[model samples]
Target: MEDKKKILLVDDEESITRTLKLFLDRRGGFEVRTENRGSQAVRVARDFRPDLIVLDVVMPDSDGGAIAQDLGEDPELQSIPIIFLTAIIKEQEIGGHGKAIGGGVHTYLAKPVEPDVLISHIQERLGV
Candidate 1:
């Protein structure tokens, strides 16, 4: 049997993290870990070593961009892909390719995104 992929979800909203973690857990094929505090994201990621990270842009304690920067700077964590989930921009702003921000290097999904769409993105990013 193949090993399940690891995913880290970083969001300030407890409900959002909980809901997403439940949904992904129920779906199977992946092991998910969530961090509600952005300030603790890097620490958790270092310990969990997830293959992918689903991050939120705005958080009261820490900025997602800063976290991403920190991850990118870390040699151990730099290879992991990140998908930004944000309400700051509408779905239309993402364009057809869903690579609106980060100069086409990163994936950004608008808030209120469908579960299937999120799953598809996750699979596509992970090549699963």
Candidate 2:
């Protein structure tokens, strides 16, 4: 059998992390790990070594954008794909757009994201 795709989900909300982790693991057929603190993202990413990262934009300790920047600067972690799950931009605001952002690895997905769409994005990115 093929190796299950690994994903690291970083968000400040326990409920959000819990739900997404369960959904992605059970329904999406992927291995999922989560961190509720943005400040710990890089550390956890180094340990988990995820194939992709699902990140939240805003957090109390650290912001997702900053975490992304840190990840990009790290040679071992720079190539990982990051998807921003944010409430800052609504789904309609981007015209249902979910594309990689300017930095060349990060993608954007508005919050309250539907599970199916999220899974589709994950599969598309992983080519699974």
**TM-score, candidate number 2:** 0.92
Tens digits of lDDT, candidate 2, 24-117 = 9999989999999899999999999999999998999999878888888888988898888999898777654455443545668898999999
- Model 1, residue 78: displacement in angstroms? 0.8
* Cα error, candidate 1, residue 32 (Å): 0.6
Pairs that collide in candidate 1 are none
lDDT (CA) for every model shown? 0.84, 0.87
lDDT of 2 at 85: 91
**Which parts of model 1 are misplaced by more than 4 Å?**
96-104
Task: For each candidate, give its TM-score against the true structure.
Answer: 0.91, 0.92
| Stretch of 10 with least lDDT, candidate 2 | 96-105
